[model samples]
Target: MNDSLTFCKAIEALAANIWPAEITAYLDNWQLRATRGVTKRANSVLAIGEYPQLANWLPHIEQFYADNSLPAIFHISDASPPGLDALLDSHGYALGTPSLVMIANSQDAAAAAAQKLVKRDVAALTAEWVTEADEEWLDAFLRLESYHEELKESYKGICERISDAKGFVKIRKGKHIIAVGTAVVQGEWAGFLNVVVSEAERGQGLGSYLMQALTAWSREHGAARQYLQVVASNTAAVSLYEKLGYQTKYGYHYRIKYDLRPLATS
Candidate 1:
């Protein structure tokens, strides 16, 4: 792998740290993570290096998730071994949620311009900083799913575990919160996670504004490079990030095997 790819992988590693899994186990080059199925990225196995022991690893991974009552999943990225995807396909693991990892130079002109617009309205935006997400942030971001206490607590635990410089941003307009995002800075790299705009507030460019705000916050705190993950099917978000000068660095997806064990016999 070249220097750029290595750097991107390093950022991904940092991301895994920022959003920690409740249970993490390593087998050679593979990272097996589980977080009660709250999020695929947190739950899936990440093949970080050549896994010559993949055959042995699969059974163990299946049992690990089975023990926890979660699906067995693997996050396959460019960093994974060659033919690993085909290998998983042959094993009956179905692919899910292809996503892109995008990166941008924080000092890029376009990003700088967006930052200016967000800075101009800094007072109106009403930024709330929290180490762990409060009910308000969870309500705005998770929306309908916020009613589930376990999921909300899982999110809170993940956010609170970020040891690096991090910020959970809640941007409000008047009494109503309009946007939410999280930024974690490790070394010169800053990763943005869970950036969402209110469903009723789409097309108003709040997404771009949120990105700029997060990027600005990141850069001010010593991050020169910014990275974010987006589902490949989210064209609107991809376009907005592209307009802000982010380019696709790599793509990854989860290969999932659902547990088919029958419920107890009465």
Candidate 2:
């Protein structure tokens, strides 16, 4: 209802719209999303509204994830219904990664100045942009996944669903792409996502450069505010974003209920 809560909801809505799930359902105002369990964000129920219906929704939600072979999960944020945390705690749900949502004014003078250091090409994902993102970029982007072909296809599908004016950038040094990031402009807000720096290239200001590039792109596209979510335990990343003028608006975490049943003997 307040501005901060509204902003948080907007960011969540933009994310759900951009990175579409294979299936989505709504219970009252809570959003249930699932996507083959590839990512928690895509699979968890966003417990964001009134909770009078929560008791009834729980069984159905549990069955939905069980059918998909995923752990039943809920994304609990500051904007979530009051007492929901206690309810989940009573149900044996355990907390997962805690994350912070940070926001900053896109027109900040420091952000504007930092943009000057970005010399690498930072463009939106498109046919020509895909061509420009060479094998090096692909290799670096897929490092954590070990270039798993299926996950790469999912990434492409996610990118394709982003109808907003968005930018997917890869910064290269010589023949090797060292950093990547994405930004989506929605009205007065810009959401920055998937910002990564090569393991070998971090601590050299490349992360800062990528942030500035995304910030500048957002400002150019008429976004007055910028926000991003980072794992709360990632002290280094939290410090970097704070230095760049971002402040924590709220925090959220996932509550996961694993299916611990033993496998059937063959």
Candidate 3:
């Protein structure tokens, strides 16, 4: 993309396909999404393209989430319209998670794909790659991520909703799955989601193996570039990506305040 804002919007579009919401409404240039508040990305208003008329849509936006028993959450970025953050601040929305959007070129993707677990570690690790996540793979991922029971269904729905070129990777040691990751290829861009390595498997190089397998999957699907979102505070993850040649292209955060104002019924 020519500018950061345009690039940011492009990533957001790719993300929508990779992490679909149960309900989506395109109001003006903003995308209002809700997935029962399972994850902030699937629940926030993606403020893109237009200068959101905050006053005009506040009530409707509030009531929309209220119907689902969630507060309004806005995904704010460097591209978000000027003063939007300030208005949210004035309206008492508390700032939330700060995340980074890191990107790597084709060379980096290939380099990661070249790293094979067979040569590095002592134990034999079996890597399996699939076009979609199955029940067994989903169970392993949920357990590794330690996701709540209430949120599992929404997460499963998100995985099922991906319609683009997608791949799911699972790394196993013996019979137990130790890692899970997903990659989606849209045009030349490959975006990663829900990458998790079992707690006991961390620091044993499985994360790198997982990334390599996912990179290979992306390459097979015609992706030439890679992007992933990581919380800025996650130093270990940030370090791993940086070593793979990823650089922070931009950053975004959520602005949220939980006040469930249910819609008025007729």
Candidate 4:
């Protein structure tokens, strides 16, 4: 493998832990992750490593998620098997949302955050770091996600299962928590998750305050690099992270095909 493909595989390996799924099963080298369809990352396939006898393996892969009442979906990245995307496309799998992985050196991100915090004049914003999440924090995070309230436990499971060093940082102005972000330190990388500024309070730079606090927390936990994944369609967030010194490290998308088995289960 070339250096670029090797690096991409490394990121995908780290990603498996950072945004863990409730269930991960393997068919050959293909990893299938699921969380009752609560989150895409948790439910999609990590199509990394070399392709096996895919013509034979694809059926089992589809049946796995079919048993779980989900469409089999593949997360396609640079490390994905050569021609896998085209094969899936030919087989009628639909293209899903594309996401970009953004990265920055921890020191550089921290420095940028420090400058942003000062220049943005967010002096009144006080930040708190909690090792464990509380109901309020989860509720706010759920609201920001625009996810159905019924999937709360699935989201909770994802967080509770994280075994790495993690800190949930929330920014407050007086008694009101205006923003929240989760930082997980795994080896040299700090993966940022569930970052959001209150809907009514956006355009006021509160997200920067929240990120700065996360940087400090991750740094103290021994992270040398910071990374986050953003949807390609989310221009505002992409722009913000670029300003904070994050650059696009890679891109991945999911290819999904709804199997009839799900309908039968339904």
Winning candidate number (lDDT):
4
Candidate 2 residues 40-143, lDDT tens each? 88889988767745555677778777777788899998778889888888888899999998888987724543654455343421111232334544456787
lDDT of 4 by residue, 113-194 (tens): 7787675768678988888777777877878767677878888889888889988877888788878899999999999989
Tens-place lDDT per residue, model 1, 1-266, is: 78866865676687788788888998886788988788998898987768846556667777778888888888888777789899889878898999999999988923555654653544555666676677788877777224465578888777777788988888787888888999999889888998888777777667767887788788878999888999999999898888788899888888988952431111
Tell me which residue pairs clash in candidate 3.
none
Q: Can you give the lDDT of residue 141 in candidate 2? A: 72
Two-way TM-score contest, 2 vs 3, winner: 3
By descending lDDT, how would the candidates be arranged? 4, 3, 1, 2
Clashing pairs in 1: none
TM-score, cand. 3 = 0.92
Error of 1 at 261 (Å): 5.8
The RMSD (Cα, Å) of candidate 2 is 4.8
TM-score of each: 0.89, 0.85, 0.92, 0.94
Off-target runs (Cα >4 Å) in candidate 2 are 1-3, 52-55, 109-139, 144-149, 260-266
Pairs with backbone N, CA or C atoms under 3 Å apart (clashes), candidate 2: none
